[model samples]
Target chain A: MAPKLPPHHSLQHSSTTATAGGQVHDDHDHHPQPRGIMRWLLTTNHKEIGSLYLIFSLIMFFIGGIFALVVRAELFQPGLNLINPEFFNQMTTMHGLIMVFAAVMPAFTGLANWMIPLQIGAPDMALPRLNNFSFWLLPVAFTLLLSTLLMPGGGPNFGWTFYAPLSTTYAPPSTTFFILSLHIAGVSSILGAINIVATILNMRAPGMRMMDMPLFVWTWLITAFLLIAVMPVLAGVITMMLMDINFGTSFFDAAGGGDPVLFQHLFWFFGHPEVYIMILPAFGIVSAIIPTFARKRLFGYASMVYATASIAVLSFLVWAHHMFVVGLPLAATLFFMYTTMLIAVPTGVKVFNWITTLFRGSITFEVPMLFALAFVVLFTIGGFSGLMLAIAPADFQYHDTYFVVAHFHYVLVPGAVFSIMAAVYYWLPKWTGHYPSEILGKWHFWLSVIGVNLTFFPMHFSGLAGMPRRIPDYALQFADFNLVSSLGAFLFGFSQLIFVWVIIKCVRGGVKAPAKAWDGAEDLEWSVPSPAPLHTFETPPDFKPVQH
Target chain B: MMNPVQRTVFRSVLVLIAMFAFAFALVPLYDVFCRITGVNGKVDERAQTLVSEEVDESRYVTVQFITRSGSGLPWILDVEQRQVRVHPGQPTEINFAFTNQSGSALSGRAVPSVSPSQASRYLRKVNCFCFDEQRLEAGERVEMPLVFQLTRDLPKDVNTVTMVYTLYPVAEEKAQLQAQVAPGSGGDA
Candidate 1:
């Protein structure tokens, strides 16, 4: 058999029969319908799918955000203002489960689905049915999971982590559905990853080398590979839980010759890579935005690729860092510690490169640039907190506390989520054929920045002061920080409504956009017509060949 | 030619795939490894008998349990603790059964999760099945087993070490959970 293409490289696929023709053909089969919902379900069109992903994620984002708001409302001034402890537990768990799995992740995957083929010049996803299958699985999985809230026992009150004993013997009746839903989600993720890998490897515009591809495509390529490698492990692990609950196995039981701690080991193994799965695409998006807005060629593109790859590899080896408080062996601890710390190097490389990319360049603070700038300041802060947690001894204090919570939220919220917002702001014009209202966009941006920091920043203090995670009620001393966080959460949740308004206004038609939305934007995506063609790049675009 | 990033991506995928395939083939391969080392938990078939008729002054059979992997999750191998006295050439049957009580899936084939350096050759009714790759939903319970023969040809010196079938939860279970949870905790949505 021919060697399978490398999952992360090999863009610029050689198309077989039909081409989208000159003017950058869309990499899809079906002709696009500029009209109805049928354009989404029956259409194999990449742009349509991408739009659907974005729209679906937005709805889920708001739904998940509502859950966050309720969480905040309850904790606003302490003493359960809006919900009981059980309801709070359900809210927090479902809030998190939905946002990450249903909202943010799907949004990014949508961006990738739409953009990857467009940028790389593919006809359509190599496996179209699989793509549909992946997206369809989301509703089924989340429906089962969200439906659990109305169940007799209430949804999984356990944290999203759902550790053993907590999810098993001690869990409510809904745990079974949660596990099965997760199994389906895992299957979806794996299928999505495989499709991405196939598309990236097999499809690309002529004369575009792997190194020559835009950073967004490059980062997603690695992220996709990470997804494929770990999702199956997730399926395998969940299967064990299924057996332990219904059948009779001692995998986690010491008395029956099983170890409970073993669950964590397996969990983190997939857990660590999963964090990158969320962020790596964001990395790609930020990379694209910064360069375009700053009016400069990306600095050290090759090094950026290496840094991303290194981050992915380091992710797998350092998983034990999360369990430092669980008592890993001294040698194992040391190894994980060093490995975790080393990630800082590659991560630092990315930060420095972004900063350098902006230096001495004609930088304008467009809506996209505004979010990009915020990402730099905030993501670095998140990274610093991460370094602090990497200290095994210090983690003993930070583990499961609000401090740890603050650190990750800083990374994920401002870091990953912020980048996503920026990408949408940047690409909205390309997809809609009109510019979103800058005034509303600015309102959305500033409110979100303030709201995000306000919501999560206080978590660090309360955590440092010893407020553990996952408990519904807390001591009076932690009341002040919780109040601030809750207020910030509501503000942040409301702020997003403006973004939806801006996007809707743009799509309905304001001022028609030009082929290249931004003056400084340099990419295959910009070479196409506004509101990009349905089946783009049926034929590859002409471009200068890479010198190297 | 692909650069280092591409090469690393390619190589790592192969390595991971190979690991998966290796994990899939764990039951038989692990058993073979154990048997080769005399750690297959099977007493020698042709070796001189430990329970000799001449030495009927109180014959005994002992089992041992040790854990080299999967720290602190409560894994054990239970043997019927009854002392049975039998005449020479009489065959006795003992069953080693596995029970998983943890909420997550436990991988049966992890290097050190199951065997304490004893009989590495463990057999199930099925081979290369997803049994070892267990995915336990909440409230899940399943049993695994090791069926063995204590032949009349067993060596006499091996009498007291308890036979322990260790348990190990696959690494991905908790890792995935933590990943899911951390994002949920920090997520804006």
Candidate 2:
């Protein structure tokens, strides 16, 4: 078969050779490019597609954030305040679905699309058209998902987990649409994961060995595998749900000779690995940032890789821990509890490795470094709470409570989301050809940290004080913590506007950046010109494996 | 004709499809697993014949009966005995009455669960009302018998086993089929 190349491949080659002096130039101008929005709608270029993914996710983050504010606002005084209980459930559900599916997961995929090929010295993703198809599927999926709110019965109110009986028998009329939307999203994820796997495995530069690849690439490769492994399971479970709802099957309906507990099992089986899929790439991003900011070779690079792999493996085993309150047998409970606790060891190794990398090193706290540091501390806090929740006996008390909400939000907002922010700040110079304003960047970071903490920290107290989650109102005893959390949520929600402003400001104009933006950075992506040309590595760059 | 990149994509896609199949496979796998370990408290569907064996008089086990009506099922279930103390290996009989309050005919099925689920396998039932649909006409009432025995080797730590039977309304079409096949068969005894 003839080698698949973009229509502008020859023009891209000419432009690369034409710019030997390494000055930043628009390669798209040299080539006959599609005009207007058509460029984005039909572009096969990885970098453009990457930008599309990022822009799309940023918009979704705000949308999901607004939904969360609705939920928080209602809980501000805790007495059917801003919205009714039914609408409140919809807000919470939509917030979780949008953030996890649209915002966090896609942001990671966007970063992967942009950086993986460049980091690995490849021209573009192995299947560029498939990449475009995958990214486009997300909007269609979410639009259908959001449109369900207007479909008479409201959108999915069964929580993101959408347990059976509640999600099937008792669900609203719009649930069929919810199932269809989730199916589309699952397909997009599987396709995206396939492209990532194929690109990493087959498109690495001639000399770039598997172990020699950046931690981001390694983590994403594993994450892609996880996605490929579990996304279909999600598809299967939802398909069963569809059958139960419309076709009169009993995959999860207890009334139809099916077990409700089975739904929890199947959902968590996919969900547990899904948790790692979001965070493993975050690990990759933090690993990349810490070494650059610390100006040190990453401590225990091999262990870091092994720890990630072990965490992915352990993720599948520990899923039953989520079902601890569902009256699992003692043996199954003990088994899950022990496996869940065992996950902490590998996670702890990663934390210690990051700290050790920072130890006595000539370290500079750039905006990215600040976020990375917070990720290390706060993610560890999330991990500790996870360990607490892993104890079966303890989980019975903490399950379906605000503490569970707090634990995950701490990990997701500070852990995964923080890592994404750090990555963007670290790489905005490369993508925009301008140094982001340090003052503005720092302002965004501090406000975000405070807002995030204020929003989630009090949840721990309220949950322990007997406050249940997914409730629109709580008793007066839990009033103060809810007040603090609501205020914090709003504070955190609005501070993100500054993040968008930073990106726009940096993109429009800032201090012009050199080819190597960070003094301590060492990666193949750094070798490319800033505001990376529309096409990069058209001719493969010789890669020298770093001596650890 | 496929290159290595295409091959990798092909394999990943295969993994995706295989995992989908694996998910569906889990349904039967879960059933088999539950049956083997009794982790889900699902007892055997097949009835067992009464086996003549010595009753373990040294041990007394408490068997508690709880009946719940599922949503949309306008039926009242009354268990003659709430709790029974019986010797291991001794056969026990319990009577349960079902009354349909609805104005029309309704068909319902009872789903049973044995709590402290590990004890599910040790509790053998020679006869059960859960084996078939319980169809009743307007204001009709029916009484049924549940004949069961606890095995002689009941675990010493398991002193109490709770059996919960939840009754669910069956669809009208299936209820009509049952009426045509077995008319007035499971009525008051």
- Native-referenced DockQ of model 1: 0.04
TM-score of each: 0.74, 0.94
lDDT of model 1 at residue A416?
83
**Against the true two-chain complex, what DockQ does each candidate achieve?**
0.04, 0.65
Q: Report the lDDT of model 1 for residue A432.
A: 74
Separately for all candidates shown, the number of backbone clashes (residues 3 or more apart, or on different chains) is 86, 0
Off by over 4 Å in 2: A1-32, B101-106, B135-139, B170-189
Model 1 / residue A440 / CA error / Å: 0.5
Please state the CAPRI-style docking class of candidate 1. Answer: incorrect
Please report, in order, the local distance difference test score of every candidate based on alpha carbons: 0.71, 0.89
Q: Name the weakest run of 10 consecutive residues (lDDT summed) in model 1 chain A.
A: A1-10
Q: For residues A1-548, what per-residue lDDT tens digits would candidate 2 score against the true structure? A: 11333233433332452232223343434655556777778777788888899999999999999999999999999688778888889999999999999999999999999999989988889988889899999999999999999999898999999998899999999999999999999999998999999899888877989999999999999999999999999999999999999987889877777988999999999999999999999999999999998999899999999999999998899889999877778888999999999999999999999999999889999999999999999999999899899988888899899999999998999999999999999999988889998999999999999999999999999998879999998999999999999999999999999999999999999999987899889989988888787668876777898876
Q: For residue A66, what is the lDDT in candidate 2?
A: 98
Number of the top DockQ candidate: 2
Kindly report the root-mean-square deviation of model 2 from the true structure over all alpha carbons. 3.8
Residues A506-538 of candidate 1 have per-residue lDDT tens digits of 888887778789988888877777777665555
